[model samples]
Target chain A: MTPKVFYISDGTAITAEIFGHAVLSQFPIEFEALTIPFIDAIEKAEKVKQQINDCFITTQVRPIVFHSIVNAEIRDIIFASEALDYDFLNTFVSPLEQQLGVKAQPVINRTHGKAKESYENRIDAINYTLDNDDGQTMKNMDKADIILLGVSRCGKTPSSLYLSMQFGIKAANYPFTEDDMDNLKLPSELKKNKSKLFGLTIDPQRLHEIRQSRLENSRYSSLRQCRIEVKEVEMLFKKEKIPFVNATNHSVEEIAAKILDKTGLKRHMF
Target chain B: MTPKVFYISDGTAITAEIFGHAVLSQFPIEFEALTIPFIDAIEKAEKVKQQINDCFITTQVRPIVFHSIVNAEIRDIIFASEALDYDFLNTFVSPLEQQLGVKAQPVINRTHGKAKESYENRIDAINYTLDNDDGQTMKNMDKADIILLGVSRCGKTPSSLYLSMQFGIKAANYPFTEDDMDNLKLPSELKKNKSKLFGLTIDPQRLHEIRQSRLENSRYSSLRQCRIEVKEVEMLFKKEKIPFVNATNHSVEEIAAKILDKTGLKRHMF
Candidate 1:
């Protein structure tokens, strides 16, 4: 039987989930997972404890609970349950407090809350990314912290959004379509902001498969077309001395990280 | 002086950052953090170790290092540094291995790397959300996992994008504009998909401030107009018996989590 794992927290539980998921993924076997967030009240904690106990009764095994609960009262209730608890927050907090010689303030929602200025910057980055997406307008290119240049299906949009969302960076992406394949050169707007340019390329076969799914049997989705477009775009990137990464084997997370790493971009953590 | 901290990983280090940030946020003081990702090589690890040692020598304070490095050799190199290391991954892995009666098969990039099916689902959801954003067309409302209803600039777009980007939920948002305030009613498509409808309401004053920043002194950004639109849309929500939440003081993460909790939408972890 697959083991049962629960990620519980008083806040969004996103941190708990990420922490547990990372640890669990190292194991070879699969485990069933559930997330229960916003467990601020004693009543809610009791109910969750019951759910864990009931799962233990049914499965004949103790469920694994990973929690970052801040409230001592509610956390104690969870500790008293039949589940094997991994107290993520308190585990690190005690040691840190000792090292720093200061007691932890332990405010709920501090990790993901809107810290006024950073929150505004993040929202602005999102809006900026949206407005400048898909070569929509070059008028605002000068305002962008980074401009992504890539073919339509080579993973530009998702990477741009991830950069802006994960880090408070103003990202704008522009596509290099088939129309620009013949005499591919940087537009005047993109040339002026050449230092901000980052390129993404994909394996032609992968590009063909992606485009075929979107537009089957069309010339745009043809293998020949994909190969030609990728070649031209890559040559342009080389000629312009622009840094680029292959998106075929990497996720958006990896791509975004690689871009920031190559460019030495400061990641503004929220 | 602000204590220096590092989030290091062999992969994207996103998990390390999230774990470190969550733990550090519990403290009342600010930290100076630097993230070094893709640290897969021994030379890279040695250089990072040197940097940590250099910082200790300069400040006479050991920097706090949080690493999720999978490779034992590379991890040990960092372990030899003068910094106070918080090894996030291995801390729980040993206990988990004993509990599960299985050895961990540690693979790099497992946490955020593209797991084929989940990655495809996420990308598809992102495309669906973008194509259907702002009620561009209600034709696809039938296909959405959730439909967000709110006035313009009341946090619809960012919330919808977050739901799709983070949780892989196809979130479609529709705006109730100034014109809709005179006779606010659900579109036929929304009425048919009422079960998937979720509402977001913001404080009129906050709404006024958000809109004013976008379009200065316009009737649309007027405080009275903001009040009228919010009141009418909220009434529509009540009359339709649609569930709603106040986005006034909440971040997008909070709003998204609340929506998932209220709707019981299964969060597809990427």
Candidate 2:
């Protein structure tokens, strides 16, 4: 039987889910996972505890519960359930408090709350990325924290959005299209902001497949065209001495992280 | 002196950062955080250990180190550091392994790696959201998982993008501009997809402030205009019997989670 797992928190439960998922992924087995977010009140915590107990009664197996609940009352309710609880928050909070000589002033929703200035800055970054996306305007390239260059659909948009949304980075992207293949070079605006330039390349076969999904049987999706565009864009990157990465095997998280790592860009955590 | 914290990981260190941030947010006092990612080798771990030791020697206070390093040898190196270690991964891994009666098969980058099909689906959702954003076209409303309606800059675009990017929900947004306020009614496409329609409202003062930053001293940024638009759109939302939330006090994470909670949308965890 697949093991059951629960990610519980008084807030959004995003942290619990991420930490639980990371730990579970290390094991070579699947888990039937459920997330219970916003368990702020005692009643809600009781109901969740009842649900966990019911699952154990039916399955004859103790469920693995991972929670980051800040409220002591609500957390105690979960801890009393018929499951092996991994209290992610309190496990470290006491030790941290001891080390720092400060008591934790636990507040619900603080983990994901909008810290006013940083929140507004994040919104600004998102709007900046959208306005500057897809070479829409080279006028604002100078303001961009990073500029991603690639052929069409080489994961530029998602990577750019991820950077802005997750890390509060003002990311602008430019596409080196099939038309630019003949004499592919940086635009004057991009050359002026050359220090912010980063290239993303994909395997030609993968690029062809991605294009085919959007515009099937078109010259844009053809294998020959994909090969040519990738070659020319990669050549331009090499000649210009721009750092690049292959996006074919990496997810948006990996791609964004790699870019930040290579560029030494500071990731502003929310 | 602020307590120094380090989030160290072999891969992106995103999980480490998130978990550490969540844990640290419980405290009232501020902390200085530094993230070091891609620490896969013993040599890299040793260097990080040296850095942590240097921090301790300089401040006469041990830094708090939170790491999710999977490799035992590399992990041991960090464990030898002078910092107060919080081994997020291994803390629960041993108990989980015993509970499951299986050894963990630790692989680097699995948490955020491209698990091909889901990664593709995420990209598709992002594209769908972008194509259908801001009522760009009513044609694709039938295909969206959620449709957000609000006045201009009431947090529609960012919320919609967050829904798609973080949760893989195809969220399309429509703005009720000043023109729409005169006859605030849902479009036919939106009326037909009423079940998916979610409304966002904001406080007039906040709306005015947000708009004033974009267009200074214009009628569009006037407090009166902000109040009128919000009133009309909210009235329309009530008349149409659409579910809604106030976006003034919430972050994108909170808004997205609230939407999912109300809509019963399954969060497609990447």
**B-chain TM-score for every candidate:** 0.98, 0.97
Q: List the residue pairs that clash in candidate 2.
A: none
What DockQ does each listed candidate score?
A: 0.78, 0.76
* lDDT minimum window of 10 residues, candidate 1 chain B: B112-121
| Residue B131, candidate 1: C-alpha displacement in angstroms | 0.7
lDDT (C-alpha, whole model) for all candidates? 0.92, 0.91
Best by TM-score: 1
Error of 1 at A69 (Å): 0.6
**Per-prediction TM-score to the true structure, in the order listed:** 0.99, 0.98
Give the clash count for model 1.
Answer: 0
lDDT of 1 at B124: 88
Docking class of 1: medium
Q: Candidate 2 residues A1-270, lDDT tens each?
A: 998899999888878888898889999888998888889899999999999999999999999999999889999999999999999999999998898889899987788747987798789999999999999899999899999999999999999999999989999999998788877889999999999999999999999999999999999999999999999999999999999999998889889989988999987654
Tell me the tens digit of each residue's lDDT in model 1 across B15-73: 88889999999999989999999999999999999999999999999899999999999
